[model samples]
Target: MKQKRFGIDIDGTVTCPTSLIPFINKDFSLNITLDDIKKYDLSEALDIPAERCQDWFNEREPDIYWSSPLAEGAKDVLLKWKEQFQLFFISARRSHLLDLTQKWFETKDILYDRIELIGSHDKIKAAKQHKVDIFFEDKHDNAVSIHEELRIPVLLFNTPYNQDPVPSGVIRVDNWAQAEQWVKAWIDSESFIQQ
Candidate 1:
């Protein structure tokens, strides 16, 4: 069977972002918790423009793109998937973080065909442009938007902040190991059998 294209997210989905939370709270002094950051509605922070929040992050942790830790089994699962799919990283990390993100990939030895750093909140447009059949993301808003607008399958990697209600047709998985199995099973099922 022919390989499929996979569009994956960077933050919590690929690399764990927990390590950066402390820096975010310390630098911003917003009394924000990890949950607050995860479910943050940038529009609601009237005192800070959404874009300025990105700047705040850059100022405090310029190397966040490279410093974020990988989730357990992330490297192994991704490397395995790379052999079977055209892996493309679709991240909301600011475009300026590209160099650091690349450095992280190099450090972990994670291979990919392409990496697209989408700084804006809007991810549906990027998914449509890429013709991504399946997306693995941690953000509820992004998953909802992409799945609804493009009718593409989105596997929402579970997180504390996103534990509430989920949009229709979006599947949630606990971790990368389970996610990898779910994806492989779906691809191997008789329903997807090729002629």
Candidate 2:
């Protein structure tokens, strides 16, 4: 069984999708559940003015990043994957947040081969540069692009924000458990094909 390189996204992929809801509810004094988040931008989904959202984000982004809870089963599955795959995290978070990201990874005891905070959701270049055999993503567009451009498999963690359609190579998974199973299947089929 040869090792593979996997490109993963942060935010809703590795962190719980509802991680920001509590903070938003606290800040806005509005009770909104994870179900209310239909778009990737909180401003758009919450109906908050973009400038206000930007200001709020600028003020609280660090705290938000620091306090984000890991996705269910993410640590366990990732720890297992670490032994057989090179984990490369490609996040849209600003490059300056590397320290916070690394600290969070340490706290969660998740190891990775590399982490890229590209300050944008466009991840095709990074995925290509890393030569990832597969990608795990939460963004609908990014997932579609990575798969279509790279001609590789992508496990898209399902979220309300990314409910758009995807191509054949993009698989929608609800949790890390499904992601693990899908990856295992891909690897098994890949091995069979290679032989």
Candidate 3:
């Protein structure tokens, strides 16, 4: 059997979606929780200007990424999958953060076959280049887009900000445990089809 390659997003998928909330609240002096973020744009959620939010993010991106915690159940599942599947981390983080990203992964004890930091939300190109059998993402449009474009299933990690409706190919998983269940079923069905 050929090993499946999974294209996964870093932030909000592997890391907790609310990883930046405390930082945002502290920096902005507003006690807003993850549920308060209705939109993917932090500025919109905070009702602040976009540029100001961008500036803050740029200044604190390293610290934020360095300290972000893994999502619940992510470590166990990913570690198990590492022995069978080819894990490729495709993130919207900039290329300059490769060292920091690798360090973060090491600190978290996560293993990967590859990591691509594309610096933009549009991940279709990277997904295609990696030839991933499936994808995992936290962004709503990104999940829909990667599935629609690549003709592959995309597991969307559910978040308050990504409550928008998704296509049939985009499976919504509330946590890594659910994600593991879905992947097992998908692999079984695919194997059956091949046979």
Top-TM-score structure, candidate number: 3
Q: How close is candidate 1 to the true structure, as a TM-score?
A: 0.84
Candidate 2: tens digits of C-alpha lDDT, residues 40-114? 888999999999999998898899989999999999999999998899999999999999999999999999999
Highest lDDT, which number? Answer: 3
State every prediction's TM-score relative to the real structure. 0.84, 0.97, 0.99
Show how many residue pairs clash in every candidate, following the order shown: 0, 0, 0
Candidate 1, overall lDDT? 0.78
Span of 10 residues, lowest total lDDT, candidate 1: 37-46
Instruction: Tell me the lDDT of model 2 at 42.
Output: 84
User: For model 2, which pairs clash?
Assistant: none
Worst 10 residues of 3 by lDDT: 39-48
Q: List, residue by residue over 17-37, the lDDT tens digit for candidate 1.
A: 476666666666756655565
State the TM-score for model 3: 0.99
The order of the candidates by TM-score, greatest first, is 3, 2, 1
Candidate lDDT scores, in order, read: 0.78, 0.92, 0.95
lDDT of each residue in 7-66, candidate 3, tens digit only:
999999999998998899899999888888999988888899999999999999999999
